[model samples]
Target chain A: MIDEIVAAPGAGRALLDDYLARYAPGARARGMVLEQVLVAPPVWLDDQSNTLTIRWSLANAGAWWGMRAVSGADSAVAAWWAEVDARAISRRRSFATAPEAIVRLCDV
Target chain B: MFRLTQLVTLADRAARDDLAAALRAVGRRARSLLVEPTLEGSFNGGDLLVHASFNAAGDRAAFELEAQALLGRPATASIDSVSYSSEADGREPGLRDGIYRVLLLSIEPGTDRDTVARFEAELLAMPRHIAAIRNWRLSRVEQAAGARAWTHVWEQEFADAGGLLDAYMLHPYHWAHIDRWFDPECPERIVDARLCHSFCRVDRSAISSGG
Candidate 1:
């Protein structure tokens, strides 16, 4: 599965570029093509933790590559994918209603 | 040199990339154009962050008009003016690649004057206790003719997203000392805090170089 992480928008873009940059050599070495398919802003779910989550998608990559990246079994791609699962797990707790509550109280 | 930071909420998902591209195309007239998406926080009904700087205030206003036209009625824009910033020394370079948090706040009614003063003081003094903050600023909104909702704005730039998460969000000082002011239970909740992220534009050339 493709892993996702939330970041501030600019940082998210830089990260996406960085990820592609870092993965390009290894991917080319393996003769695989990696293309970023989508880079969109987060859909703020009331149940979501990050208010602005940048969702990134890549095309022409397989599950094996994703698994390797997530598992951190290989040091080369470990740094990039290691935090994917961690961020997803942390986002699971849900602070969805917090923003609404704050807005109600402060009226901003 | 004036920079206008507008916190905007997209009318729909479709407007995301279109608006970003439009802002970037504003071109040489703009010193810098940064479009940041809010990943994990919200304020002022905004999810998209648009920051643009210009050499002249007139150019900045012209850009705003163009931006509003592109954004259309579906989006709402709030412009903030820097009231106090540490970057006046000119030593600060362009925004670093990291997780930047922009906080919009309004002190609750009936809050003691001293408490408000202390809250602002401690907020500025946060770097002394937490080391992850790379740069930060506090600004007050330049209210237009109508009523303004948020009065104060606080911005913090972290070394990275993890640094923001660990050093600020989960810090002991933040939890023990800072969190209380914003406690929902307290009638004097210091302010309604709206958190958003700021990012540097991606370096496409570096990505292509595989660096």
Candidate 2:
């Protein structure tokens, strides 16, 4: 079961690419460089509450260059994020708390 | 002294549990070499969390090498070099066991150096206000060159999980003084996780009842 999940394709890179494609240029225009982006697999919390969590870590060239992707006038990245949020919410409601399903989404 | 905490996601429940057991056995045999060694499944079901403190950097490195060998793979690990420790004050460190909340943060680009220093100072002084904090340490990552690197680490050990959820997380001072740096509009990125474990070496009797 775990092997199947780990072998599945990940949406992280595609999603990150979309985000960068939409927002990276604006960030560069503002003199900030998006050094790196990392997305981890979905984690199932054993707190008995059936919480599923994901982690995304971003690194910028400097301290001032952060937050341009989700903030400011550009709404493209924000809109994309909202769609991801919606998907997560829907998943939470329908997810059977199955370990396999959790593992599948967490494949990063 | 330095501490290495590694968080890794395994493919299955069995593999995760197996690694935890192996770490526990290693801890049992190397009691003198490692302090408060811990291996447990993270509250998140599929991940394994390992934490061990060493009196010397060489010991810490050797342990990491051993752990990597045990796992048969390169694990995602964060090794924090302690830059400031309140335990160095000669007082019995109150934070030996309980729930540990760790925050790894990268500072925003172009932010004033002075502002970052002031923010750090406020964080170091948090125990002065919040009575629930048992042990608090803030350290800078010596190697911040990799994709997994974070600029600074803030670790606080509380009496229980409630101390984190009820007191520290909800504290007004934390929001007013510290939270802004992590705002989405700000220049910092943060990854935070909590671990529930006990320190084997801390003398609970020496810890003060008062904050």
Candidate 3:
């Protein structure tokens, strides 16, 4: 199962590409279907919000570090990410988490 | 004495778990070489949990001291900090973060420039350290922008084109403070090499914790 998924390099990238193509034109469509495909299998999906958080404690340290990614269902996951960059660049939105820095690349 | 932490981003959750489990199944024999945790869990948020101790060694005084405090030392030991973006759970508006925890302890008469330099050299020469940082940086750049943007700006500049950024780039906020880290001889090279090695140790610890 893992091998099959890993073998398909462009599949994940393509799914993301399709989401962008569909939503970039202001489709305002439900993005859940696309979200389910692009991110679900690879990530451990958290249904309530379609967002994932990774957390870990510093070795022997009391502090915990976390990173998060979220998307809207009506928009392509890639579209959501695109908008994130747009917003960050436009100063409309600020990244509260560091992980978003890398997650935004999924659209490329 | 100074310590370094290292971290590696697993390509996928299963890969992360598989590596962790593989490390754990090997048991005490492996534990003797490094520090690792005992409990493990993967959060609904897409990150994995690990609790382990560092392997005991004669020259491991620094690690042991910091481990007692459970605090990461700054500068000399806490050499590198990098982030990675992984596939999201799809319900949130942010990317999931994968962190490998590596704690370095400082021991003895204290760390000096020359000592750190030697350590930096040894650490960077290790293959595992280079591989982990390369993957982590790639994942980070991707999350910062779309794949195309990252490819054009980061990956293409570093990995694909073999540009100067290939070995080192400071975190935006840390650039100023990073300046004070090393002597003038080869700041960029040394810092990059040091950080890469530190991150590899963190990655190794995370894998060990899972098992």
* Structural similarity to truth (TM-score) of each candidate: 0.52, 0.50, 0.20
Q: What residue runs in model 1 are displaced by over 4 Å at the alpha carbon?
A: A1-108, B40-45, B74-95, B109-115, B144-148, B193-211
DockQ of each: 0.01, 0.03, 0.01
lDDT of 3 by residue, B33-97 (tens): 33232113211111222222233332334433333243222211221121222211111112123
- Candidate 1 vs candidate 2, DockQ winner: 2
Which has the higher TM-score value, candidate number 1 or candidate number 2?
1
CAPRI-style docking class of model 2 based on DockQ:
incorrect
Clashes of each: 10, 11, 54
- Looking at model 1, residue B137 earns an lDDT score of 60
lDDT per residue for candidate 1 within B82-110, as digits (tens), equals 22222211112344455556665666667
Classified by CAPRI criteria, candidate 3 counts as: incorrect
lDDT of model number 3: 0.26
Compared with the true structure, model 2 gives a TM-score of 0.50
Candidates sorted by TM-score, best first:
1, 2, 3
Model 2 lDDT tens row, B1-211:
5555544445444565567677656654232322232224223211554545556666666766677677654443323322211232112354454655555556655657787788788888777767677776676655432233456756666676666655665454553345545533222312222212222223331223211
DockQ of 3: 0.01
